[model samples]
Target: MSDNPGPDSDPVRLTAWVHGRVQGVGFRWWTRARALELGLVGSATNHADGRVLIVAEGRRADCDNLLALLDRGRSPGHVDTVVAQWGPARGDLTGFVER
Candidate 1:
């Protein structure tokens, strides 16, 4: 992949739909920590539909690494699935927040 980050290239944005025993489990906190460690900015929140939605922005590699970590269930809970994608990055997010 081209390492060059074009002006139009927003940071790498990843929206993950994490499932399986994710609620009430500090999953958001764990994700926030990881995102920070990876120098990413975003937020993670629990959905009423019993799933967690994590939106993160950072370098492409960092985004991929975060997804890998999630897929490996490095967090406190189990991650049944991690649906991720790459898109135009955005402005510097104000830290990782829980919504």
Candidate 2:
């Protein structure tokens, strides 16, 4: 089987800064689990400034779905806003991890 994707399959990378009640509220854990379920690869890190930085790489639509989840945030962690940047996938990540 070819590892290469077909022309119709557009991969993407999403760098998102999640704000509001994200720190120590299971945000990273939820992100890691959800990302893996979506067959994504990347990492989620907690910033000292009370923000969660998530880098997700996957199919364009999957990445978008992940972002939507972040927008709603999770229970116990009310998400105020999600600042995201999207681009072509780099294919450098192996699996989703929380940091």
lDDT of 1: 0.85
TM-score of each: 0.85, 0.88
Most accurate candidate by lDDT = 2
Candidate 2: segments with Cα more than 4 A from true spot = 1-8
lDDT of 1 by residue, 18-93 (tens): 8888888888888899999999899999999888999998887788888998889678778888777668777767
lDDT of 1 at 81: 87
Alpha-carbon lDDT of model 2: 0.88
Candidate 2 lDDT over 1-99, as tens digits, reads 999877437888999998899878788898998899999999999999998899999888899889988897453488988999988998899999899
Q: Which candidate tops TM-score?
A: 2
Tell me the lDDT of model 2 at 36. 95
